[model samples]
Target: DVKVTQSSRYLVKRTGEKVFLECVQDMDHENMFWYRQDPGLGLRLIYFSYDVKMKEKGDIPEGYSVSREKKERFSLILESASTNQTSMYLCASSLRDGGYTFGSGTRLTVV
Candidate 1:
C-alpha cells in the first residue's frame, strides 16, 4: 500500500519564528508537493519537487520553501512564520500527476 506520513498533525508557532513540516512517502514517487489550505484562498501550492535535489516553486511560494534531498521525503520550511501563514499544510506524492496520494496534513497556527 502507498502511504504518506506527516510528522505532526498540528503546530503552533510565534510570529517571526521558523517552522518546519515534514512528509515521507512509502512508495517511490517521482513527484511530491506541498500545499496550504485557507478559507478564502482555498488550496494553494507552495512547492514541489520532481526529483532528488531538484525543486520548483508553486503558485504561492512567497514565505515558504521546500527541500527534497532524498527520494520519498520532502520538507516544507516557513522562513519567517507569520500569523497570516497559519493554514492547513498538505503533502502529496505520486508516480505522476494522474495519481496523487496525500498525507493527513499539518495544521499550523501562528500567533
Candidate 2:
C-alpha cells in the first residue's frame, strides 16, 4: 500500500516561531504536495515539488515553504508561525495519472 506518514498528528506553536512539519512517503512517488485545510476553504495548496530540488508555489504559498531533498521525504516550513497559519496541514504524494495518497494530517494551533 502507498502510505504517507507525518511527523505529528497535532502541533501547537507560539507566534513568530519557526515550525517544521515532516512527511515521508514509501511509494517513491515523483510528486509531493503540501496543503492547508480550513473550514469552508477546503484544501489550499501551499507548495509542490515534482522532483527533488524543484518546487512550485501554489495558491496560498505566503508564509510557507517546502523542501524535497530526497525522493521519499518532503518537509514544510513555516518561517514565522502565526495565529492565521494554524490549520490542518496535509501531505500528499502522487505520480503521473495517479491519485494522491495523503497523510493523517497535522492539526496545528498557534497561540
Candidate 3:
C-alpha cells in the first residue's frame, strides 16, 4: 500500500514565528503537493513538485514555500506565522495517473 507520512499531527505557533511541516512518501511517486484548508475556503494548494529541485507555485502561496530536496521527502515552510494562517495542512503524493495518497494532515494554530 502507498503511504505518505506527515511529521506532525498538530502544531501551535506564535505570530511572527517561522513554522516547518514535513512530509515523506515511501513510494516512488512522481508528484507531491502541499495544501492548506480553512473553514470557508476548501483545500487551497500551497505548492507542488514533480521532480527533485523542481517546484511549481500553487493557488495560495503568499506566505508559504516548499522544498523537495529528495524524491521521498517534501517540506512546507510558513515564512512568518500569523493568526489568519492557522489551518489544516495536507500533504499528498501521486503518480502520472493522478490518484493521490495523502498524509493524515497537520493542524496548525497560530496565536
Candidate 4:
C-alpha cells in the first residue's frame, strides 16, 4: 500500500506558537500535498511539492509553508498558530493519477 505517515494524530498549541507537522511516505511519490479540512469549508490546500526543492502555493498558503528536501518526506510549518487555524490537517501523496494517498490526519487545536 502507498502509505503516508503523519507525526501526530492530535495536537494543541497556544495562539502564537509555531507548529510543525511532519509527513513521510514510503512510496517515493513525486507529488506531495498539505491540506486543512474544516467543517463546511471542505479541503483547503496549503502547499504542494512535485519534486525535491520545488514547492508551490496552493489555494490557501497564508500562515503556512512547506518543505520537500527529499522524495519521501514533506513537512508543514505553521509560522504562528491561531484559533482560526484549528482544524484537521491532512498529508497526501500521488504519482500520476489524480487520486491521492492520504495520511490518517492530524487534528490541531489552537487555544
Provide the TM-score for each candidate, comma-separated: 0.95, 0.98, 0.96, 0.96
lDDT of each: 0.93, 0.96, 0.94, 0.95
Please write out the lDDT profile of model 1 over residues 1-111, one tens digit for every residue. 779999999999999999999999999998999999888878888899999999999999999988998998999999999998988999999887558999999999999
> Candidate 4: global Cα-lDDT?
0.95
lDDT of 2 by residue, 1-111 (tens): 769999999999999999999999999799999999999999999999999999999999999988889999999999999999989999999998779999999999999
lDDT of 3 by residue, 1-111 (tens): 779999999999999999999999999998999998888988999999999979999999899888988999999999999999989999999998999999999999999
- Per-candidate total of colliding backbone pairs: 0, 0, 0, 0
List the RMSD of every prediction in angstroms.
Answer: 1.0, 0.7, 0.8, 0.8
- TM-score, structure 1 vs. true: 0.95
For candidate 4, write residues 1-111 as lDDT tens digits: 669999999999999999999999999799999999999999999999999999999999999988888999999999999899999999999997768999999999999
Better of 1 and 3 by lDDT: 3
Residue 29, model 3, lDDT: 96
Top-lDDT candidate index: 2
After superposing candidate 4 on the true structure, give the runs of residues whose Cα lies further than 4 Å from its correct spot. Answer: none
Looking at model 2, which ten-residue stretch has the lowest summed lDDT? 91-100
| Candidate 1 RMSD to the correct structure | 1.0
Candidate 2 whole-model C-alpha lDDT, 0 to 1: 0.96
In TM-score terms, candidate 4 sits at 0.96
